[model samples]
Target chain A: MLGGQFLETAIWGLPIVIYPFLSGLMAGAFVIDSLAHLFGFKQFEPVAKLAATSSFAMVLIAALAPLVDSLQPAKAPLELYFRDHFPYSPLSVFIIIWTLYVILMFFEMYFDYRVENIEKSKLSGIRGSIARFLTFGNNNISKESLLKDRKALFIISAIGVPLAFAFHGYIGFVFGAIKARALWTSSVMMLMFITSAIVSGAALVTLLYVIGYSYYSKKNVVNIETLNALGIFMIFAIAFDLFLDFIDKLYSFRAYTEADVFHGWTLVYNAGGVLFFNYFVVQILLGLIIPLILLIFKPVRTSKLMMVIISIFVQVGVFAMRFNTVIGGQLLPKISQGTIIPEFPWLGFDGILSSIGLICLSIVIFFILGWLFGWEDSNKNGFENQTNSVDN
Target chain B: MSYRSDFSLKEADEDCNQELLSANFMSWLVKSIALGLGGLFALSILNSSDSADATEKNNSNLPTGPINNHRWMGWENPVLDDKDGWNDWDKLLNPKNLPVWYDNFHEIGKTKPKHHWVMVIDTRKCVGCQACVIACKSENNVPLGVFRTVVQVMETGSMESSPNGMVVTDDGNYEPNVKKFMLPRLCNHCDEPPCVEACPVKATFKRQDGIVLVDYEKCIGCGTCIEACPYNMRFFNPVTKTADKCTLCVHRIDAGLEPACVTSCVGRARIFGDLNDPKSEVSRLISQYPTARLKMSQGTEPQVFYIDLNGNLEGNTSMDKVFMEYTYTIGFNTTAYKKLGGEVDLPKIEEHKNPFKEFEK
Candidate 1:
């Protein structure tokens, strides 16, 4: 088995396979919160709020991702957070950490909301009592309480930073342990997951902010400075990702491990090959590189619209990388001692039912949660007021 | 009595406090000492077991010996040796270090056989007889659609011939000659095996005798090992969920007899032996004739050598077709197949039209 690489096993099926993605998203959210609140980067204040909202959405999705594998989604909790399963895998460890993080994030969000509602609400009796219990009976909007809450937020955000990275980085480690498949056997896969996480997180923030500011207000509060800074960050992240990709590909080529390079070459040059150069150039260069270059330029980067569009490309580019990495590694054949050839389904094999449906459900849940928590609305309301005041 | 009755509430509270304080201290001290001893005892047991278990597993079953010696040790029994000093190879071989080439073995008499057992499969000599196949099936009780040895017939030239029984060529009717040959395929039982490496659970392990075997109960049914065998010899037995391949009749071989397939071959094409023994039949044949192995470039170093191997090194063999069928599940992607030298060209079928679309319009 080509030096016994186990990377392919980590990505064999869908629901179990989505562990890396869920863990990565959570890690990215925590990183953002850490940057804004814990590290005290005032310019990164928007990211703190954004991270919390995304964290909440991602935690909710992760809580349900396991249910996709179970016959009964509701009953999954009994086997997971409640009772012990026979064998403990890396996935089991991830589930435990993810559950703890989700609970903590939920409570933190609840506490924040309760404070806000304590100021807004005039309800009495049980509703009031429940609200008081959540806020610890303090409805005071005093400077001291706000400062204390911020400190607590900072402490949790700091703790969350590494927990987030561990969530996804471990998935790569799992794949690397598989020595059977040559394509998935390298240490570089872990780094690839991490870099991709950064790109996705940055793009997500850029998209959300641009949409919130543009639709809600006649004037955009997000100036050229903020948008340009984000674009520069994204460009560099994408560049680093490409650099890592080059290293990984070159290493595989040099090692001749499991015929990965040979198989990759044939797919590139063969007449009837499914993987065309056009698809490669579009997905890798035009979608990822060109946008990165455009973002690097101050003139283009300064435009909020340009930044948002590039962010979308960055996100798409990262997904293309993931697809190629997962699908490309598996398409080679193993011959005991002869030349091997590989063939793949032209349309690409459809992901398992749970994997696709769970991912879709996660997206829906994210948007719905975003709506409920006023994540988009707060920015929208803030932007509109600023613009109206400027006009007056 | 009058003085005792006159005791104030403060005095009574003090008496109760003194009694309760002594009991609380005693309970706390006793519990603390008991917990400390229990923790220390548990820690020692855990520490000892962890180290001891690890040592026991690692002390054996690791690659630390010459393959033949390891095989010998696996089969040896000190108590049952004869006066002549013939070791207990009979007891040792079966369920021990019997090579993958072993299919079965049995004893005929008490007299020691003059020659150590060996078989040689001349690909040039094989005539695709189904007799050997049937014999092997009955002898080994092999499962349906599964065989210990399969005959792969490859035709090098076109079927059509010129008049007077001459092979036709596009250039001169002489360049491309019609050539057909039969290669009876079985596990090579490689010295360095890819299948063993591919098994995550160590279910498919290599014996010291250079035979690879699958522990069916231990196998996770991942089918990864099946994909790793370049010869495409191993197959997943759906019944057991473990990778199954030819075991060269280890039972028969251990009993000082030939494998079922080798014994049954009508053409006398199969051979089995220990290459290590200088006087063995396999060694004699190797010295006497030029020998080759199927797909030697796979780096497995197969123990089963062929006399005068006729097939092309890069030719499309029957094994390639089987490999293509199970590629997806095993993570043996399309890329690896092309790289290992398989024909990229296949007959392209035109896309079918959607009748529903036409009907709807």
Candidate 2:
């Protein structure tokens, strides 16, 4: 046959990559929060409030990722819900599930902080006024009311566990459901997304807890037990994530169809240089394997500085995993036999700037929430000691 | 720290006053902006709905006579009368010569055509002229860097000989000679289109007549449909800010006119008609030839069929030799080519010296 060239451009870019990464963080953080409240894990008690609020903040920002990624952000709601409603679409289902998850997180956080909100409402200034408003005019801080709030919080957190999994799992299904793209169509894609989300989420919250407690609090308090527990969780999640990656690769290799072969070659042979290096070096070796090996040793897991450093690597590696999944899938032409498309430009509306800007904005929002809620003051013993002394 | 009794109520009141003022101002600003944007969107939607209602009402009131008036097309025209019609109206409406699908008029008791549109590409007649591609671009105003229809050329076989010997003289050996074929691809308008299922907003959908169309106004340009399509036929139209693909020229089809690509095929390679009608050209060709659809294993049940699809020309298996040659344009870079780990440069096209004529016995 005569040789003719066909050129196809990458349609989805950085925004798509960032959106899934953000959503994964939201799901992962919320699951960690649930581990304390529902399962009664005493080791996670110190960071329980931090994780809950962080989860709430992450969802708020994560919701905006897809909207900003849209070419028509303003019209998205009208188009999605009214004009072009497809209830069966995974994306539409994701939106519904994500909204419910956010609401559940909000209620859980609100009830957990209700008693504190009543006390803060007595203080002078805008902080007090905001706290008062948040309490919904019911200043009842009675013991019975607090017990009811605890029950509600426990129930919501329990519900939130699976909802968080579903939220991130559906995000995976968004790509996995596309039967045409061999790389994304695996049954393991959803499991892979969930596991990686846990790794990234745990890493992020660990970093935040260490930084927030050390810098923001008056006493510069550091909960060694809590940090160590989070480190252990991150290690296990990363190991599971790596295991899933192995299973996915094994399945693809065994299937060995033309499309599967092409997908495998693309990743292994550096068909797209960025994807190959990103997967092997950054994601696998540095992100998953190194972190796993480091966390297994008691010295590294117990050392606060070492744990922080390892978590940072885990975070970067998990993000790289998301990048490899989202962008790598689009790199190849849908035709199994076709060549890969060019890399998307890093500048402009759909580029890396949008991704970084959104992430920075989310971080800023989280810090602002942390300050407003006085999350830095949330020490388990510190709160109990102060209240007991006051009663005496 | 002392309990709430430490601060005076007057001090708290002063602090509350300042905070309330700022909070009220921020709330007001947000409300006003939201209201302003909401009004504008509502107005636009209302105006569009009003216009659509008017068009429907006008169409229902159209006159039934002068069925052969070309100016009326499928759209109604009350001004047209039998007195102003051409003499060949009876000849044009004759079912024996023309299929029932050809009639666009809505007579009082006339039934709608039981038609399912399809296309048949006779690869044997194609000469890689790319006339259909140009015609489709012109008709659809498809932007550069993306295509609604493309004529891809596939060449196979290697130009190297075995290590231990001279070049083999086998007919199947492509070392000294290569065989090429042209494939004109467009939207398959599949019976079970994945794009429709993948569209979160349902912006892309299949019509009752089997044409896949994108609702530009409703599309948010999330690009999910573009990823869902196995053919890579869909593209993000920057101008429209929506996902776009070949609509099979529904505008012309509705008017009983052939698609621009079908009309402009220089080699008479493309045949378009109602596949449901056994006597239609496309249906007849399907029956006569052992036609094949691209990626049939995908189960998309594509409507477009190809005649005489040669071996090694199936699917995108032959894209290794295919090179996309075009002038560099902004927003039109081929990421797929770069991802394939190839040097991103346009190679010189080799002129064929009528090798078939030279090799003839």
What TM-score, computed on C-alpha atoms, does each candidate reach? 0.55, 0.80
Candidate 1 ranges with C-alpha deviation above 4 Å = A1-26, A52-159, A212-226, A252-260, A268-273, A302-304, A336-355, A368-392, B1-361
Q: Per-candidate RMSD vs. true structure? A: 15.5, 10.2
Give the per-residue lDDT of model 2 (tens digit) for A1-392.
Answer: 01112336556677778877888888888877778778877677667777877777878877687787677787787666664344557888878887798778778767877777878877778887677667665667666676677688789988899999999999899899887776788888999999999888898788887877777667647777778788888878887898998877676654554554455445443535446778888989999999999898887877878878987898888888888887777665654344454454567677677788988987887877775664643444634443354345
> What would the TM-score be for candidate 2 when compared with the true structure?
0.80
**How accurate locally is residue B290 in candidate 1, as Cα lDDT from 0 to 100?**
89
lDDT, residue B223, candidate 1: 49
DockQ of each: 0.05, 0.26
Q: List the TM-score for candidate 2's chain B.
A: 0.61
| Model 2: per-residue Cα lDDT at residue B6 | 57
Which model scores highest in lDDT?
A: 2
i-RMSD per candidate, Å: 13.0, 7.5
